[model samples]
Target: MPDTQLTVTLSGEGVGDARVVVRALEQAFGAPDELPSDEKATVHMATFTGEARAEGSPTAPGHLSAPVAVTVQGAPGAVRRASETLARAFTTRDEGAASGDQEQERQLLLEP
Candidate 1:
């Protein structure tokens, strides 16, 4: 099968919280193909190639308690897997009902 590329973007109050989310994503999808960098030092973005797996529960220790927004785009299966992984790490309520196309992309607002 062809590789599936997933892009995850995190934006929130503390960069540490974003970093924690990234670590969780890495555990699910393996190391990111493109790691986040400080372009302007506000938002964090990373990309991974492949379907995600739930290896284990990811924890954030010493991370700031703040709100986080995560966007994941990839194949439908990969997106679903990533969404499930993220839901475990952060408290998320569905932003809106997803349509068929929307299912391929997930947008989650997370709270600590």
Candidate 2:
């Protein structure tokens, strides 16, 4: 199977909060292939490879009580699964539209 990549970008007040969001992503997608630069960075990023699954770990309230943007790129199936997991983890606001033709991609804007 082709490798799937999911990149989650979190913008919030503190980096600690961002880390919490990253941890939530880790719970959903397994250990990330890459993590954000430092704790001081405002906009943090976490990249995960392969399929994403819910680990049953609950994220803290304040962690996602901000604005977050997630992007999933991979096979159609993988992207759909990742998007679903993230949508559930983030909120039930809206189902983000999917784009890209050959290489599938989905962009989700989440708010807590």
Candidate 3:
């Protein structure tokens, strides 16, 4: 099977909040290609390349200070897995989603 790749774009909060979300994603998708940098911008992005964890030790979800808007784009299964991972880590409000022949995208609002 092709490697599942997930691209996550985050905004609304700062790097600290972004890290929290990234950490949650790491639990399922493993480490991202790179860590979230301190770019002093409103948005941060990371890409994870691997399969989602179906069996592993569960960890406590991290806390968020303010709401974070997350946009995930990837293969259909990868998008769904990442969205589910974020939802499990924080309270998420479904914004909307789109689908193509081979890829899917979803937007979610995560709150403390």
Candidate 4:
């Protein structure tokens, strides 16, 4: 089991209702902390808030905005890399990218 926590910004049109948002988050996290989703992995998570962002010039009639945010959690050490482990998930450059130990050697558990 992995408890990897990470954060990234999501941009989309009409993110939808709270229920839909929670469902989306559960899908994103790959599991449910306090709800149900389609993911098979259990990565407990919670989103505090997602404030709408205003886009475009002030004079423009049509503008769009997406909520930017910070997420926190823990994941596999091999799959996560850095000089130091994250101190309570804050933010990441992006998701599904090799963010740790890009060149570390792999050894069998029973080797040593």
Candidate 5:
């Protein structure tokens, strides 16, 4: 299996909101080591980025956040489910999402 990325975002009041978001994700999808370790399934994690969005409201209330992007190389269905759940768990709205190889495959420049 190849490496992948995952992003989880939380949007709400103050800087502490992000931490709540992270906790929600960990609960929903499991921790970094908990994802799965297999020749066919390798889950690698990247730290999420949070920034205040003065742009008013989405589904919750005032302010918003950048979506956390996650990537990985392995099972497609599992990855997609994990991604969706992560978003749904964090906020009252679906603020988080996971984009796998499909999103990754398009960008060559991101390669190391």
Candidate 6:
């Protein structure tokens, strides 16, 4: 299988809001390499491996105190899957995307 590792970065009102986003992703992609944390910074990040599972509880709109800025990066398919999964779970605005020879990145603004 092509590398399906995906990295998700999020910045929200606080760690709690970010966790909500992560939890939604966990449903579709299983657990991440590590959970998101403040790390004394404004953003948190987590990495998920393998293809997104087909069977899982359907993602629903998660509550957020404020909009969350999310960035997904990895193999093109992996990035696309992650982005779509998030959109299904939240009101999202596509910020844009960029592609490299071996990886892709997309940004989204997730609303409450």
When summed lDDT is taken over every stretch of 10 residues in candidate 6, the lowest stretch is: 53-62
Q: Identify the superior model by lDDT, candidate 5 or candidate 6.
A: 6
Q: Relative to the true structure, how large is the alpha-carbon lDDT of every model?
A: 0.72, 0.62, 0.87, 0.28, 0.33, 0.84
Report clash pairs, candidate 6. Answer: none
**Clash pairs, model 4 backbone:** 3-74, 4-74, 4-75, 5-73, 5-74, 72-89, 81-100
What is candidate 6's lDDT per residue for 7-107, written digit by digit as tens? 89999788888888888888767788888775466899988885677756675636898999999999888888788788888888999999999999999
Q: Give the per-residue lDDT digits (tens) of candidate 4, residues 3-111.
A: 3343322222333322233343332343334442324422323432222222222221122233322233234332232112221122223332332432222111100
| Model 2, global lDDT | 0.62
Give the per-residue lDDT digits (tens) of candidate 3, residues 25-110.
88888888887888597999999986666646657657899999999999998888888888777899999999999999999999
Stronger candidate by lDDT (4 vs 6) = 6
> What value of lDDT does candidate 5 attain over all alpha carbons?
0.33
Q: How far is candidate 6 from the true structure (C-alpha RMSD, Å)?
A: 2.0
> Comparing candidate 3 with candidate 4, which one achieves the higher TM-score?
3
Off by over 4 Å in 5: 1-4, 9-11, 32-79, 86-91, 94-101, 104-112
Expressed as tens digits, the lDDT of each residue in 1-112 for candidate 5 is 2222444222223233334344444443334333222333222332422222232222321222443233322344434544544445433332234456554211010100
Q: After best superposition, candidate 5 residue 73: deviation in angstroms?
A: 13
Runs in model 1 lying further than 4 Å from the true structure: 1-4, 50-54, 57-64, 97-103
TM-score of 4: 0.24
Better of 5 and 6 by TM-score: 6
**Which has the better lDDT: candidate 2, or candidate 4?**
2
Deviation in Å, model 6, residue 56 alpha carbon: 4.2
Preferred candidate (TM-score higher): 1 or 4 = 1
Pairs that collide in candidate 3 are none
Model number with the top TM-score: 3
Model 4 spans > 4 angstroms off: 2-21, 28-31, 35-66, 76-112
